[model samples]
Target: MPDDFSWSDFIQRALPLAILGLALIGAPLLIFEPEGLPRMRSLSKELAQVRAENAELTRDVSKLRAEVRELRDDPAAVERIARGKLGLVRKSEVVFQFGKPR
Candidate 1:
């Protein structure tokens, strides 16, 4: 009811155009901008790191499996490991060591 304001004019003339402009702006944001922007790049970086770690873990698993197979089927490998790691020897053999001066 002020001198320059008209509620009837706003409802009849401005509201529909305002709604149309908002829809025009919002439609592209909802459709293309979401898919073509930040989330895809973030997910791509995460996927690359996961693939690299998966390859390293796969190689580790393969090596462990080969060692396990050898330990299961090879007695000579087990004896070599015991001799090197545990310092084991036959009852008649003696081990001698000499010390180095600092």
Candidate 2:
């Protein structure tokens, strides 16, 4: 509106603000675009896998605890383990072998 308001003056006044606005808009992309998003996705997948493995291990531990309790409190369970794992027989029982000859 004034005679002294020239193109140079307009550029001088607008350049710094334009630069600042562009920096504000572009800083995040510059900082995060290359690696941050992909790394976050990778870490999220790893966390999910770890949680799944942890749940499976927790189930295994519970099963083992139940087996331990059964083996401790139930004579039948102990006898089964002994016969199946240790090949033990009662004193009154006779052993038999019917396998093919080696």
Best by lDDT: 2
Predicted candidate 2 versus true structure: per-residue lDDT over 1-102, tens digit per residue: 987889998999999999999999888886688577777888899999999999999999999999999989999999999999999999999999899979
**Candidate 2 lowest-lDDT run of ten:** 30-39
Write the residue-wise lDDT of candidate 1 on 1-102 in tens digits: 679998888899989999999999988786567676567888899999999999999999999999999989999888888899998987888888889978
On the 0 to 100 scale, the lDDT of residue 44 in model 1 is 96
Clashing pairs in 2: none
| Residue 74, candidate 2: alpha-carbon lDDT | 100
Question: TM-score: which candidate is best?
Answer: 2
lDDT value for model 1: 0.89
**Local distance difference test, candidate 2:** 0.93
Clashes of each: 0, 0
